[model samples]
Target: MSSAQQEEEVLGKAYDGRLMGRLLAYVRPYRWQVVVATLAAGLHSVTQVVGPYLNKVIIDRYLFPTHAPGSHSLIGNYLPADPWRGIASVALLYITMLVIGFALDFLQTWSMQWVGQHSMYDLRRDLFHHLQRLQISFFDRNPVGRMVTRVTNDVEMINDMISSALVAFFDDSFVLLLIIVVMFRFNWKLSLITLAVLPFMILATRAFRRAVRDSYRRIRVAVARINVFLQEHVTGMSVVQAFNREQRAYDEFDQINRVHLRAWTDAVFAYALYYPAIEFLSTLAIALILWFGGLRVLNHT
Candidate 1:
């Protein structure tokens, strides 16, 4: 493997505070936008939880009305007693929540993307300036493709982290926290039973992360190799043609392209397994909830 490939293959710490701090520095100028995006993400998560809660309320109070007629809570008192009217009101509320969720989602996505683009612009500008000031020996030591990758692909990855990954992390955390609270509030025993599969889920997630990490490293290395190979060969096309090396060059490129294809295939396979594993665990949790909760209901517990 070439030096560039070796460098790309060396995976660093997943979460380095120093690196994160440096990245955040670029985001400092757009702090307000970040705050807005964060808030929007949180609100969107609330909407997600609220949608399910609304469904439960509709079923319990309006559809079935299993509880005593006069025992309705303050919020329930506001709801129409007539089933059809209550359904209409709840349905309207559900639609309103959907619209609000859509707006929040749009705001979060737009603001983060705006921040990401601006941050990347600043980073790329600074990187180019730094490259310009470096000694001639610096250029000699680094391949053009590697430097190009740093300026383009690597910076784009940082943009993606800012625009998608970080926001998603926050949104998911909020959603999970809300779900746990809601679950425990509704039925502590059932919640405990539902969470019993959490350990297995965690283990599966760890394994999935490891597999994906390895695949990502391989993909990065393959990308660098492809860049290096193309830069060298394409630039010397005249020389290659004169020496009748077109077929050889094509064969070499084919090999490098195959490496990239295999790397992507591995990534796809990992994702396929990871999602199904998570879904299976979720199904198991739901099954357990039904079995245990049904017994409680039958026993009038």
Candidate 2:
């Protein structure tokens, strides 16, 4: 199987519905916090949208309509019929948005953390519980490192991916979808232009992901080899000195360090190109929006 396919299979085995369902069963008592947190996320997104709309209105109705850039107005049309009243209204609205956004952000951070750490607590408990149930023969055959790897590093990676990447994916995708819908509503032609380079962006993303994965894998291998070399030489230092094998050990260490350097360089090069390409595409979208939106606004059609 392809590495991508293998990775997916591993993730699937790690997070089967039966497994997660059983895990979430422990969170039944905290369901209220989960529900409230989800609602807060929605409100956060809503307020984010509201802030920008308010800015656009202020620009169009007050700034753009009257004072040119760098010119100070005499506090005329920009002021409402009641200046303090209008100022107070804007301030209150902005404060409300800030308060809501902060509250939601805090709730999200807390909820995701509570859910993640709590789930891990239950999972580790179960894994240890299951490990104890295994026969003594299994333990005799498998090295302690193997078992430690499963319970420690593997579990940590899985938890990090689910809590950080999974949550981020959901939040980012929902926000992106909502933004795209709004953009389409504003101007379908511009939206199409904005999305025209999506395939390229996706391809770039996949390439970067592969590059980083390979770099980290190589780094891990190199580190392991170095560790083994160090352990052998340190343990057998007396024999090595008697045989005068210091030069040989130095050469081996140099080779391992070179491998690590090469892997890191490749990773850096991949991201160096990947990020600029993505940024260029994003800039192109802005240019397209301006060129197209300007035409529509000019024709008033």
Quick one: best lDDT, which candidate? 1
For all predicted structures, in order, the TM-scores are 0.94, 0.70
RMSD of each: 2.0, 6.6
Stretches of candidate 2 off by over 4 Å are 1-34, 65-88, 135-141, 215-269, 297-301
lDDT of 2 by residue, 169-214 (tens): 6556656777887777665777898898889899999888877877
Per-residue accuracy of model 1 over 1-301 as CA lDDT, tens digit each: 6665567778899789999899999999999999999999899999998888888778788767777442343357678889899889888988999999999999999999999999999999999999999999988877888788889888998899899998799889989999999888777889999999999999999999998988888887778778878888889899999999999999999998998899899999999999999999999999999999899779977
Clashes of each: 0, 0
